[model samples]
Target: MDLQTLTYIIVGLTFVLYIGIAIWSKAGSTKEFYVAGGGVHPVVNGMATAADWMSAASFISLAGIVSFVGYDGSVYLMGWTGGYVLLALCMAPYLRKFGKFTVPDFIGDRYYSQAARTVAVVCAIFICFTYIAGQMRGVGVVFSRFLEVDVETGVFIGMFVVFFYAVLGGMKGITYTQVAQYCVMIFAFMVPAVFISIMMTGHIFPQLGFGSQLIDAAGNSSGVYLLDKLDGLSTELGFNQYTSGVKSTIDVFAITAALMVGTAGLPHVIVRFFTVPKVKDARSSAGWALVFIAIMYTTIPALAAFSRVNMIETINGPEQTGVAYDTAPEWIKNWQKTGLITWDDKNDDGKMFYANDARNEMKIDRDIMVLATPEIADLPAWVIALVAAGGMAAALSTSAGLLLVISTSVSHDLLKKNLMPNISDKKELMFARLAAAIGIIIAGWFGINPPGFVAAVVALAFGLAACSLFPAIIMGIFSKTMNKEGAIAGMVSGLTFTVAYIAYFKFINPEMNNADHWLFGISPEGIGIIGMLVNFGVAILVCKVTTKIPNDVVLMVEAIRFPKGAGDAQDH
Candidate 1:
C-alpha cells in the first residue's frame, strides 16, 4: 500500500483509541476533571507525565535543533532534563503535600491573598499559551506533510482532536490518553533511530552507533568517526564544523538555567504530581518519568548526527558538491509542496547547494528534519507512516495537558476560587469545558501564526515560567516570611521585564536582536534567568520591609517541608 493510505489507517486507529479512552475516563466531577480524582497510580502517571514532558519539542524539534546548531543545542538537553531533576528532587513531593489543586491555588493560599492567585493565573495562562503554540505548530507541520494539507487546515483539524478529548476527559481522560501516547511516541521514535543506526554504523544500538566508525557501502569500516566525517563535510560546504558552537559562554549558561528553572515552574507539569494520591507517589512518578524521558533524550544526538549526514548527502549528493534540482528526490518535492523546503538557483546551474554563505540555495525548515528523516533514509512505507502517527501523538499529548492548565486557570483559579466562589460544581465543570474549548481556538490561532520555530518558541515559554513562577513557588515552600506583597511584586516585575525584553528583540525590533542589543549578551531565549533573579531579589527586598508571617502560616510552611506520609498535609 501507499504511504499515505497506511498513515491514515495507523493514525486513525490511534485517534480512535484516544477518543475511546476519553469516553471511558470522562471525568464526572470537578475533582476528576482537575486531578483525575487524585487516585492515579505512580507508574501510570509517570508514563503520562513523560508524554506531557516530551511534547513536540523533544520528539520533533530536539534532533533538528541539534543538527543545525551543533554543540550549542546542548543547552536544551541540559536545561530541560536538568530542570526536571530539580523539580523531582526539590518541588514535586512538597507541592503534592501542599494539597493545592493548581499552582495558582498554592500561590493564593500560601500567600493568603486573592491578588496573588490572580497574578499566578495570568502567568500560567500566558506561559501555557506560549508553550501550546509550539505543539500546535508541530501538529500542523506533521499533518501538512503526511496528509498533504496546508498548515492552517492541519492546525484546525488538530484543534478538533485535542479539544474533543481535553474537554471531555479533563485530567482523567488526558492522563490515560497520554499514557497510550507515550507508548506510541517512544516506539515510533526508536524504530527509525535503530534502523538508521544499523544502516550507517552497523551497530545494534544508536547510542553505541553514535560514537562508532561509519560503515562504507560495502559493509566495511570507513575508518572515520561520524562526527569527524560530518565536520569534514561541513568544511567543504563553507559551514562551521558540526561539532562546534558559536553561542557565548554567558548566553549558554543563561539559556540552560532558564530552561531548567522554567521546567520546574511550568504549571502543567507541576499539576501532574497533584493527580497522584500521595506525596510519595509524586516522587515515584518523577523517577519513572526521568527513566522514560532519558530513553528518548539519549537517542537524540545520534539521530541528529545520522539525520544531518543523510540530509546533506541526499541534497548535495555524495560528492559534497551539489545535485541537479530537477532530479531532486521525492522528499524535497513532497516537502516543497508544504512551503517548508525552498530551493532557488542563484548560480543558474540547475543544482542545489547548501552552505553557510551567500551561495546557499536552499531554505529548509528545521521542523521538517525529524519528520522527513524516515523518508530521506528510504525506510519502508509503514515506518514512514508510523512517524506521522508518532508526531501526532507527541503534539496532541502535550497540547491536551497545556489546554487543561489554561482551562483550570480560568475556571478554578479565576472564576470558581475568585470570581464566583459560590458557583455550583456542575456549573463550574461546564465553565471549565467552555474555557478549554476557547483555549483551543486561541492556541490554534497561535499555531497558525507562530512567532518562531517550535523549539525557540517553546524556549521563550520556559523563560516566561522561569521568570514569573519558579521564585514564587520556591520561596512559598521554603520561606515562612515570604508575604503576599513580596510574591506579587516579584512575579509582576519579573514577568514584565522578561516580556518587554523578549518582545523588543523578537518582535518590535528584529534588526536589534544581536548580542550588542542584549542585556549582558543574553538573548531573549535566555533572559528569563535574569528575570528569575529579579524576582528573587525583589521578593526578598520587599519581604524584609513587610509585616511578619502569621504563626499559622509558618506552621503550614513547616508541615509542607517535613512531610510524614502520603496525603498528610493539612488544609490551611
Candidate 2:
C-alpha cells in the first residue's frame, strides 16, 4: 500500500523471478556458459540484446538529462541509437559469420597474434568495469530511494542477486532473464510517460506532445511553443537555452560519430551477436533490437519536455514563487528523505522560487526523476512499484551481461585457451562461474561508492571503447597488411590518449572543464573523435614502418570479409 512496502515487494518479486530462471536454466558446459549453445532464436536474441544494451543509463538517467539540458540531449538519443545502425549494417553480420566466441578471438586470429588478442582483452575488461560501475550506482540509487536503505547496503543486495544468476545461469540464464527484464523495464518507462503526455497535451503520443502548443486556462492557445518556453526558462536560471545550439556543430558531429562506432565496437555487445544460431539471424536481430530500443529512445524527449515544464510550474508561480517547504507535496517530502532532492527557504518566504539562487539551488538527483515519476504524477501505487522493479531489472540485466563477459574472458579466453590448454571443459566452466562471482563483488563495491554521474561514467566507457578496441577491430577487418605491431601500437596509443585526456579534465585541471575543453575548442565529451583519429593514424604509420603482413594473415582477413569461408573460422 505504502511506497516503501510496494518497493520492497516489487524488488523481491523480480529477484525471485531471476533466481528461479537461473535455477531452471543453469548452464552445464563451456558452450552453454559462453554463448547459450548458439541456439537462440533471432527475435528472442534481439530482445535479450536490447536488455543488455539499455543498462541503467537508459532507464534511469537519459530522460533526466534531457529534462535539464533540452535539445542538446538529442546528441545522446541520436548517437546511442545510431550506433546500433552501424552495428547492424557494418559489424554484426560479418562478425556473426566469423562465428568467434569473443571480439578478441576475431582480432587474435585475424592478425595471427597472441599479443593482439591480449590487448583486446585488456581493453574489453577496462570498458566493462568502467561501465558496470555506473549500473551498480543506479541499482543503489533506486534501492536507497524506494526501499529506504543505505546506498551501500542496496549495492550489496544488488551484487548478491547478480552473482546468484550470473554464476548459476551463465549466458543461458542471463539471456532468458533479460527477456523478462526488457518487458518489465519498458512497461515501467512507458506508463508514466504516456500518462503525463495525455494529461499535458491531450495527446497519447509523447513525441507529438513535445511539439504541441501549450494550452491556457481559457482554452486558448498560449502562442509560445514548448521548446521556446523551455529555452527562456533555462536562460533565466543562468543555464543555456534547452533547444538552442550550445555545442559547436563539429563537436556534435564528432561525438555522435564516435558513439555510433563505439556502440558497434563494445566487446560485450558484439558477443551477443555470436549467441544466435545463424549469421543471417544475427543481422536480423540487430534490426529488431534497434526497434525495441527506439521505443524508449523516441519517447524520452517527450518525457524530458513534460518533466521540465512540470518541475518549473511546481516551483515557480504567481501565488507561490516556489513550493512552500512545510507544505511541499508528498513526493517532494519522500524524495527529500533520500537526500536526492533538497530545498531551502533562503529568503524566509513561504513561497519557493525555482530561480537559480546559489543558496537555494535544488539538488534534484537525476536518477530520481524516472523512479519518482509515478508519485509526482499521482499514479497508482502499483505503477510506482513497477518502476522500482523496472529499475532493478535494468541494473541487474546489464550487470549480468558485463560479469559474464569478464568471467568468460578470464576463464575461457585466457586460462583455458592460453594458460591451461589441456584443461577440461567442465573445469573451465567452473572457473568461469567463480570469476563471475568475484567480478560482481568488485563491481558492487564501486556501485556502493560511485565515482561520478551515471551518464558521465557511461560516456567515459564509450570513449575508451572508441579509442582502443574500435580502431583495432576496424583496421584488422579492412586492412590486409595490418600486422601485430601496428595493431598493438594503435590500441596503446588510443587507450593512453583517451584515458589521459579524460583524467586531465576530470581531476588534474579545474579550468579545462568539460564545457571549455578543446583541441581547437572541441568539448572533452567529443574528444573521442580525435582519439579515434589518432588510433587510425598511429596504426597506419606503425604498419608502414614495419614489414608486410604474412600471406596467411591476409587470407584470414579475406575470409572474415566473405560469407562463404566464414563457416570454418570458429575459435578451436
**TM-score of every candidate relative to the true structure:** 0.98, 0.95
Q: For residues 1-572, could you state the per-residue lDDT of candidate 2 as single tens digits?
A: 77678878887888899999999999998788888888888899999999999988889888887887776778888888888887788888777777778887777777777888888888888789988998888888888878888889889889988988899999999999999999989999898888887777766888887898766656567787777878877777777778876777887887888788778788888888888887778887898998899889999888888887777766664342466666766887788888888776667776556655563446777667788777876788888889889899998999899998899888867886678878888898989998998898889878877775445567678888888888888787777888888888988898888878877776678476755556666666767777888899999999999988999878877876875422522448
Candidate 1, residue 228: Cα displacement in angstroms equals 0.4
**Candidate 2 deviant stretches above 4 angstroms:** 215-224, 236-238, 318-320, 357-360, 452-456, 514-517, 564-571
**What C-alpha lDDT do the candidate models reach, one value each?**
0.91, 0.82
Q: How many steric clashes does model 2 contain? A: 2
Give per-residue CA lDDT, model 1, range 66-96, as digits (tens). Answer: 9888888899999999999999999999999
Q: Which stretches of candidate 1 lie over 4 Å from their true place?
A: 451-457, 568-572
For all the candidates, what are their Cα RMSDs to the real structure?
1.5, 2.1
With a 3 Å backbone cut-off (N, CA, C), the pairs that clash in candidate 1 are: none
lDDT at residue 364 of model 2 (Cα atoms): 78
